[model samples]
Target: MAARILAAALSLALAAMPARVAAALDMAGVFDSTGPEITISWEYLETPGRKAEMQAVIDGFAAMVDNEFLPRDPHAGIEIVMTDDAAHFASYMRRNYPAIDIPKYGVFVSDGRLVTYSRSGVGTVTSLLLPGLLRDGYDDLPQWAVTGLRTYFEKFYGFWETDAAAGQRVVRFAHGYHNPWRLQDIRLLLPDLKLANLVSDTPTVDGTRYQSQQRLLMIFIWKEGKLPAFMAALRARDRKMYPTYLEAVFGQPLEALQPRFRAFQETILAHWNLVMRTPPSQVYADRATFEAMTASVWR
Candidate 1:
């Protein structure tokens, strides 16, 4: 009777403990590096050559942030986690950060940590580094702008595999114009959806497509030497001020620019149709599947 009572008491005590305290991770063969701007925690032991290759990728990413993106020194350096087992990594994150939300693909936590389970590659590196840079450099920018900058970087500097038989050499902008058909879908929806509403609203599949269009629009504005002023207006954080800013930058009122923008959109669609020999509408018609996937991941 006495032994049974003692065992019951111990079980109760264990059950009362916090989940984080109860769930301790035992990571094996983890390798870590602390650089000036980023700290990488790789969850696998790497050989000397592999370590050198990863180090070079990290260094290149740091240099890009320091030179092109970071307007000021980051208050806390970014922490990055690379692992093959995303589910396991997410479980550990949940234990420590009970109140915080974890994104399906890596996320930038409030405390300057970027945890990811992405395979080591140029695309993954770009995905992780771009968010960190945007978070550090333009923390006050709206989500649309932050996401736009990331897509812009990927469109210009990212790589894609061409031939599986030829090993892993990647070519830049391999998708050609960064999701062109998706941009057409956004253009088709624009008469019903306003730009300001699209930016400020919760993310949906259509909203995601709108964001891609906005990014392309921003890139076009940048090419016309108007991005600096436009970004300045966004930094002011007044939605009402956008029309005036748009006029100043584009030399036309918002309504006038729509017709011009529509013309530009048509030209892009025509060019892509000529190259790919497919209608943009038919190509991007599967909205239901895309929305379901987005909802599931975000949920």
Candidate 2:
């Protein structure tokens, strides 16, 4: 009888203790009240502000190309992992993708994983990232795809034009201006653009030079012609018959369009274009001093 009483008393004491105090707590879930609606897991560790800035860039990009493609669907939201250290980044990549060649700076992936090397050949590779996203090219993209995407981005993302005398033009950076290129109407200045007769991504074309040409052509289209219709046509695959598409678009054959495109090219050359200037330097915030410098620049 005494043993029974003692057991009952102990049981009551245990039952009376608060659940939280009595049980092992899962601290990780404390702040994670909601389940994963859209899971984003990254290897990169960032401060609150930097993380927020990255999120904003993601949001802006989503807004730019959302539902533009067929099926009228929102892009499957992505996970952007940022690494604080190169060692960690490399470890993550090695663990996740063993076969990929590491990228030069950072990689962009749509359907496939992008491995960015801290360096690529002799130069820092940044253009590779932007075009990767724009074209959704996983591992490989043709020269045309690269050039075409570059052209598309320059046009959609408007810049500050520094106009000088004697028909010189310079593009200044615009703050938070999305979709610089206006691709709606391509008629007002058709003759010169037609003269250039620019076709992006042809066989035997110099890719780097072609990309530069494509950017200029896009600018000319926005300034002189109906850009949106052209974009629509291109997107719809109606442009497979290139000359016919041109004729239908401008009510003229390629011969008529050639002279105009050439003239347009001349005018474009007259401007002090920096669309394809020197490549950008790789940005690393690993060092405290470098981080401070970057912060100051942003400030």
Candidate 3:
């Protein structure tokens, strides 16, 4: 009888509260732990090879961080708080972490805590590694460099589904810079994206374009194969050094690189156009070809 009364009182409080504030505290089991088993989805268990594939990706990423990128431990390791509720996560982030760029569906890291909203399947694997690399000296790393490196490693987010064929499982992953994103159609927005505008202190104030713009620049950086050199050289960095870094790292003025940049985008846009024209079956018919074409841009 007391429990029923308590529940009723809580409901009344929730009804009276503002929508945003109410949503922020709406909790349905938040697991605040950092363990491999914690993130294993039910879909992985039901699929035969999915567990192994996902684990391999996870293990490989951890190894790279341990051996190559960050040899020492972060002074304070990350405390991950994951929840299934997207509105709860968004509201909490907005209230508590106003300065951080709250991804509509991905993980966001701040202040030794890695928070994720599982409504979109934990976002891409690339972003999950942020807490690992974000340590003592990294906060000063420019936002463009940070976003670019993270988005550059991001390939796709794949999930298994029942195929039309008998006893078949098909994998469909959004394979692009905008995987698991709210904004997928950049056709109308791309025309106005310029490197000169991008290389400024802040790439964009618009939430929709900020990630995309940083990603666009990073693809060029990776294709140039100077990612390490680029990141390293920029340690002597400044907010205004982005254009200078591009010129120094690419061995050309920003003006010269613009055409080359446009050429690369043209290739990507051409591929996108062709895929739009083709039927779904034809578009995904050659997984190898599609994956190759997507990764080819980075190479």
Candidate 4:
């Protein structure tokens, strides 16, 4: 009798609340906050310090997006949910987003919301929003610009320091991991891998490689102080006409650029070697150790 009474009272209380508030309550033990560009909600597991740090990262990310990518303010503010438990998050997401496949660590729901099930540490908060940002901004950008800019911002948020130093590290990593095939050989292997093919929403292996190549190209442009002009050109023209615009901006034909691309690859390799020789600093104290412990859950 007492249990029945308690259940009735609970239902009645929920019925009295606004629909949105009631729905929010269904995902119990969540804390919500509103920022200028985003609304964030997280599991109760987040400590005060961590929450503040995440907010700061989000603010910084928003500033970068406004200044670099979007010509107008976003149509809608983004929503973010950080879940403490992976299994629980997955179940909730499956119920809410039945059509989308949920990744183990993060997912961007169709409703312009980002959901992340893992939190490595303070420094890594930017990564949690990246997949969603990439997905959201993809349609508005040209194929070459999408991954290149995404990588550039990733390095920015990951390092949270000066752009030049972060860009150098990103270029080095891309160079170190790239295949040793010549430009002609790569072109043959990925014959259909043109900027037009990247318009498809589905992910593919060839597409991934194309994105990497674009990243390398962006790094080269950045080093040459031509990135701003390149980005302006991208914004002013349509994706189909990007190749023509590219040649115009660089004042060279595609064939003429191959030798310079090869030289850029060699420079990246040299930078990678130099970076690998340097030891890491312990500025974050035990943050690295904490991140390692949480790696299995996220990474």
For 147-261, candidate 2 gives per-residue lDDT tens digits of 5544444311112122333132221111111121221122233234433235523433354444544555545454555555554554554645554444445666668666666
Per-candidate TM equals: 0.53, 0.50, 0.50, 0.54
Worst 10 residues of 1 by lDDT: 20-29
lDDT winner = 3
For candidate 4, what is the TM-score?
Answer: 0.54
lDDT of the structure predicted as candidate 4:
0.40
Q: How accurate locally is residue 172 in candidate 1, as Cα lDDT from 0 to 100?
A: 18
Worst 10 residues of 4 by lDDT: 168-177
TM-score-best of 3 and 4: 4
What ranges in model 3 sit over 4 Å off? Answer: 1-59, 66-71, 74-135, 157-185, 189-192, 202-205, 235-243, 274-299
lDDT of each: 0.42, 0.35, 0.44, 0.40
| Cα lDDT, model 3, residue 50 | 41
Clashes of each: 0, 45, 0, 0
Cα lDDT for residue 270, candidate 1? 56
lDDT of 3 by residue, 11-57 (tens): 21111111111110111111111223212332111335543443333
In model 2, the Cα lDDT at residue 182 comes to: 21
Show where candidate 1 strays beyond 4 Å.
1-37, 85-102, 107-110, 120-147, 150-176, 190-206, 222-245, 274-299
lDDT of 2 at 218: 48
